[model samples]
Target: MQNTSHLLMIRPVKFSFNEQTAVNNAFQQNDTNNNVAEMAAREFDAFAQKLQANGVDVTIVEDTPEPYTPDSIFPNNWISFHEDGNIILYPMFAVNRRAERKPHVLKAIEKKFRIQNKIDLTALEANHQFLEGTGSMVLDRDHKIAYACLSPRTHMSALNNFAEKTGFTTVAFHANDRNGLPIYHTNVMMCVADQFVVVCMESITDENEKKLVRDAIHKTDKSIILISFHQMEHFAGNMLQVQNNRGEKLLIMSTQAYESLTADQIKILENYNRIIHSSLNTIETNGGGSARCMLAEVFLPVQQTQ
Candidate 1:
């Protein structure tokens, strides 16, 4: 399925601005407020509640305080659950971020879902090669395509390896921000939902690469919702589409992202699904991630319960 009704969220305990990730993640701001952790925890609870209110299944696990993973709230970077009963663990770019992949977290999930296989790519960290799960590639699950904006965190070798293992075709390109710095993660610049994609076209300066990406999206039979650099800055492109228990599609985004959209863009997107946005200013500002990053879609098969 392109969208999952179930999700996995990690409630942050030591939530703060991650210095290790800020090196390439231009979106992170140095949150000076001493109550940063408290504010982030509240924002996380609200976001999860918003999803639950919409009938989406959410399994939230508290981050272990023993190892400080400041960016642990954004679990999409380290793990992605597949419908084929596979749980793929990705190689993280930041050393601190690596600790976010916790075995107990998966054990918590296993109580509700069955894991048939494990695709462990963390070994690539030994080679200093990385592909940070869905953050590195915006997957078109329905079309079996992985759209990627190659950067320091997303490498060709890892993408190829993933494709070889998962039967996905990778459409890779280079994308940069206003100052010509590489976009840290593909999810920041583009989001592939069930029926439409929100993307920052201006970021893909290479005309040929832009066309290639558009053509690839067209092949997947998805409408491309173009977002400007300004909107992208507000996390507009960082959206995800998920289904509720009633099978209604809901487009999830941060309030910052929703407010940034033009009326026309909003109309176009609502044509496909209902918009569900909540305030995530604190999380987005300090975490360098938005709603999409906070959610790790769980497509695993449900465990049989007697």
Candidate 2:
């Protein structure tokens, strides 16, 4: 299944500007407001409510305040829940971000979801190689293909390692922002849903690799909606498609991202699924991530009754 109704989100306790992630993530801003955390929590709550009201299953976990992990709201970077009852712990790039892997987080998830194998990739952090889970790779799960854009935060070694262990063929490429700096994470510029893919083709710089990426998605029989670099900056590329309990497909994105889309683009996307967007300006400004980053898709099987 490409889309999952179940999602895991961390309700922020210390959500604010992350200095460590700001060095590479161009999307983050420090001068957002004085009360960043409060506004972020409100936005989080609203987004979660909207998703749940639409029949999406959300498992909300409260974040610990002690660690001072300002970017913990974006949990997709550290852990991924898979369909085979496997959970993968990834090695994060920022030193402070590494503290997000608290054991209690997993324990909380285990109560509702049955996890079979625990794949720990944190050992790679010692060698300065990081993958940052799904943030580094936009996965086409139904086709068993991984689309990755390499950067300091997304190392080739870690990509190969994940491919080796998961049996997902990798389509690796390099991408840069409009300013010519490498984009920190692949999810910032691309999203692979079941029927189609949303991507910033301008960011791919290399023509050959761009063609390869297009061919890969085409081979999988998915339509492509090419987003401009300007649209990408507004997080138009960070959308995620998810199924509801009623088996309806819905495309999710931040309000900023939805407003940035062109009529044609919106029309194309609407043909595939209903679009659900929420205001996330505060979280987007401080955390440097949007709606998709806040959601870690929970693909693990539900705990059966006795």
Q: What's the TM-score of each model vs. the native?
A: 0.99, 0.99
Q: In model 1, what lDDT does residue 306 have? A: 97
Collision pairs in model 2:
none
Q: Which tens-of-lDDT digit does each residue in 181-229 have in candidate 1?
A: 9999999889998888889999999999999999999988888889989
Model 2 residue 41 CA deviation (Å) reads 0.4
Candidate 2 lands at a TM-score of 0.99
Candidates in order have lDDT scores of 0.94, 0.94
Against the true structure, candidate 1 has what lDDT?
0.94
Q: State how far residue 147 of model 1 sits from its true place (Å).
A: 0.5
Candidate 1, residue 152: how far the Cα is off, in Å: 0.8
